[model samples]
Target: MANRSWLPYSISGEIVRGFGRGSNELGFPTANYPSSVVDALPDSFECGIYYGWAKVNEYPVYPMVLSLGYNPFYNNTKKTMEIHILHNFSNDLYGSHMTVVMIGFLREEKSFKSTEDLIDAIEQDIAIAKEMLQKAECLRLKESFSYDL
Candidate 1:
């Protein structure tokens, strides 16, 4: 089990282009972080799906799900932090500075039986995250979010 001691860890980084799977294949667009942000995480941090709050370029905070791992499904060798913000945005997010406050862990990364299974898992993660972020404590994080952090 990952150390739950760092449940609300926060990190900031500029969005970068990923493997294009999120939007092109999975239908869920994600704002990816450069390797530096992923490298800065604590040694105890484990790869998994996490629900959190995120804001781009100091915009209003929104619920987010972060996939931090080697993405076994894609057989990726490099680790990544791919964040799927809950709200849809009209503008392209590449190069935008984003800050995320991880609030809770949902599940660890795993390969599915098929692409359909993977898509279903992602959809379920989003739904569970939306419900979890509605709580008073999680709401406080979103409500009190500031780029200053």
Candidate 2:
């Protein structure tokens, strides 16, 4: 299991451009923290899926599902912190400032046998995140998360 103490953590940074797979392949657009920000995380922090709330620029807080890992399924060579905000944006977010308050862990990162399986897992993760973030504790965190960025 990953170190839970490191979580319930908040981080703010610019969303940089990634490989463009999230939208082109998965149909879900994701925002990522720059490598400098991502590298600041503690070394023992294992990669996995997480649930929480996030704000993009001055936008309202939104439920989110995060995939922090090397993406074994995609054979990614570098680690990434990919956050999928559950909202449709009418504009590009390539350089937007985003903040996330992670409240809970969903599952360990795993490789799927096929793209269909991976998509299914992503859909499930979003559903679980939506439900979990609605809980009292998570709701409280969501309410407390600052939207200044």
Candidate 3:
């Protein structure tokens, strides 16, 4: 089982730099976060699809699709945390502090070809995640069955 406690706390940080050739599809302008900022996160963080709310210092945002993974299609290099803010989330978070509130995990990260394909897959993931999140029974099941690992 994967440990998720590492990400227990909501974090506020800046986008210092970002890399890779995959973020373009999500309309996520890629940039890297400083080592200090990234390292501040827990060491045992679990990687997966996540839905979250982000408050950008410069702009407003709605629910954002957060992804943590190594892009296998582009030769897995470094792991990344990329977010695709929903419409009305346009703002420069590059040098500003943004707070991300993780709501739920969608799925383990994986790479797919074709921008359209990726977007379609994300749409489905988000739909399932939203439905699951809204159901108290489902959340109970998740907690009751969830293991610390």
Top-lDDT structure, candidate number: 1
Give a tens-digit lDDT track for model 3, residues 43-130.
6777777775555664544455677666555555676676666544344456766666666677777677777677787788767756
TM-score of each: 0.95, 0.95, 0.68
Task: Give the better candidate number (2 or 3) by TM-score.
Answer: 2
Evaluated against the true structure, the overall lDDT of model 1 is: 0.91
Query: RMSD in angstroms, candidate 1?
Result: 1.4
Clashing pairs in 1: none
For model 2, residues 83-110, the per-residue Cα lDDT tens digits are 9999999999988889898888999888
Candidate 2 stretches greater than 4 Å from native: 147-149
The alpha-carbon deviation from the true structure for residue 143 of candidate 1, after best TM-score superposition, in angstroms, is: 1.9
Candidate 2: 10-residue stretch with minimal lDDT: 140-149
Give residue 149's lDDT in candidate 2 (0 to 100).
40
How many pairs collide in each candidate, listed in order?
0, 0, 4
Model 2 TM:
0.95
Q: RMSD to the native, candidate 2?
A: 1.5
lDDT of 1 by residue, 44-145 (tens): 898899999999985788899999999898899988999999999999999999999999999999998898999999999999999999999998887777
